[model samples]
Target: MTSAPPTTEPWAAPHARGPVQAAVSLPGSKSLTNRALVLAALAEGPSVVRRALRSRDTLLMAGALTALGARVETATDDWTVEPAPLVGGGSVDCGLAGTVTRFVPPVAGLADGPVAFDGDPGMRTRPVGEVLTALRALGVRIDGDRLPFTVHGTGSLRGGRVVLDASGSSQFVSALLLAGARFEEGLDLLHDGKALPSQPHIDMTVAMLRGHGVEVDDGEPARWRVAPGPILAVDQSIEPDLSNAAAFLALAATTGGRVTVRDWPAQTTQAGDAIRDLLGRMGCSVLRDELGLTVTGSDRIKGIDVDLHEVGELTPVVAALCALADGPSYLRGIAHIRGHETDRIAALATELRGLGADVTELADGLELRPATLHGGLFRSYADHRMAHAAAVLGSAVEGVRVDDVAATSKTFPDFPAVWSALLDAR
Candidate 1:
């Protein structure tokens, strides 16, 4: 987390006096960048991840890999990961990153000694027990069930059949599959709980595994078979982070402005890509061309009734948009988000209500009714998505302030600058 220190000073959220016209180029996808780094570290040869996101979460991942004996050169936009003999006796700081907490343990299980893992004070509540318990069932010696645990490896793991509940997060599924190819007997993972969240994230994991020359059989529902073999190294270029572009695009959707996000991929498995359809349903004009993707707001922002179980990360910003709508909205099927960086549903309800919106926090989602919005202090809860949500409402609601705008650097390093630039757009 090389971002600026968290401050007590509240940042006044910029308001759009009129329609905004802006075009901005976003950074690389953190999801893709972290996954690429892990795979490259486990590959048979050196791998290059071009245009990787140099944010807090991704940097934590790179650091974890380095702690486990991989040489990760992140000095440039392109990061080169050199695979070395897996050793242990290292400690990894998870740093409030769900990816780091979930993804690194499997890799740590292949090291020669004991590797310790811990994260931010807030990450204590997040779930890593599912992954840790599953790794134990797959023949890895683990000291604890959650963060602040240690993986005692004998330089290998006996991975085979393991079934556990992954309903809480898709990262658990991805964590196992990423290192399954290196397991001695390979891996057969099954989900024996409720429905999984973020199916696209799991799909993304599968695609990346295949791209790295690892064989994965996900032909059956809720079941994946990974065949043990050498992971092939491949040079790769990352797609722009559409998720980070959400708050920026929200500026247009709220103010009848026009915003273009540069280098939007024509096809993607990114969950953030769903924002186009989401915004469109809210009466925003969406167009995709060689210039990239553009979203223009309508005279009125309409409330939507939609299920966000597959795209829970977008909940905060979507909830903010719902707060700005003239009508009511029902966002459901995302109860799993209770386990995110913060309890997002509760945080949204508290913050929105504080900002003078009619908000009802439900067990699975939220119910937002139209109300006149006013500005108060909007706190970010040390969660980047929370900060993005604050900015969304603040754009229309006057006198909005964010407690810690630097929290945006978790994935979007240039967020403050980009936001100022967006407001300056005419």
Candidate 2:
């Protein structure tokens, strides 16, 4: 992915002058919101999604579903989705949302017309061929394997047993499962490749489907069977995004302060909840109470060695934490992240190295050693999580500006305002 143009001014990330102590509340989970929208679009009745995240990614999901004939009312924080007949002859703009690019097409196959799909330039590089190939095998007509392709629909899909490698992304599995209930034979899908990445996301899909009265058998590893039936439209309450809390909690961890994230769920299917364990392992004190989950930073940020295969989304912020530690850290089992919004592993290595950290870029993850980090412009490569890492670094190492802090708009509507509010800055 390309960085913002040279002419674009960078956002000067707020530097923490002292221990950062604040109770922060984040927006709804983008993952859940998008998935909820998709389920609502295919459900048997109208659905309400409460406290939905109104961001670029989620808005794109709503727009894509609307384009394919789902009426999504998004004027307020709560979105109402009304399912209708899937019509053909529509064009969809996936933006940069992997969910929109990957998840929408499978449902579009149930339409009776042709749906053209395209997205942001970066999305063209993301791994989406698995969805298209799987759809083709399930008796759907797809014109191309990549972005700028078209799904020619004839009103129904012959869904049955299909095997493909889902090692690149878990969304491929979820895309089909989200729309599988309406299929004639349903979907019996199996992963025939390396270890599947983001298994929690697939689990989230299965759980939600079951909640919506869709029968899913996930007792077998990397195998999911969806039975043919109608999807019930259910009201969904989106939990406060635990993943976005990473940066705020990192503020406490990096500055030896205490930060509490309000409404942190006691139980969640979100893989981001893994951040609690990660921060605790890195020398932070974690506690849960009625107020929320609180993180108190340790005076010494200890380095860690761990695999992040299930929680790859935590890599960026976690990498920044590793850079500021007193010892070396190695993060592994997240090679699949290279296909995310950007080449996250490469972007993190480049930006961290530029900011004066000892970094080694491996095929799977990163190895970071303690170094005297200084101020520099950390390019985000148009990826939201990359900007998160930069903001976390700026809390300790001064002068760490982020190029294209707006990239966070993909998840949080106004991350700068949120981050600045932690410092009591407008």
TM-score for each model: 0.98, 0.98
As for candidate 2, its clashing pairs are: 88-113
lDDT of each: 0.92, 0.92
Candidate 1 displacement at residue 283 in angstroms: 0.2
Tens-digit lDDT track of model 2 for 149-211: 999999998899988889999999999999999999999999999999999999899999999
Candidate 1, residues 1-426: lDDT per residue as tens digits?
A: 122245658888888899999999999999999999999999999989999999999999999999999999999999999999999999999998999999999999999999999988788778989999999898889998877899998899989999989999999999999999999999999998999999999999999999999999999999999999999999999999988888989999888999999999999989999999999999999999998999999889999999999999999999999998989999999999888888888888888999999999899999999999999988788889999999988888889999898888899978887897789666
lDDT of 2 at 303: 97
TM-score of 2: 0.98
lDDT of 1 at 275: 96
Q: Which residue runs does candidate 1 get wrong by more than 4 Å?
A: 1-6
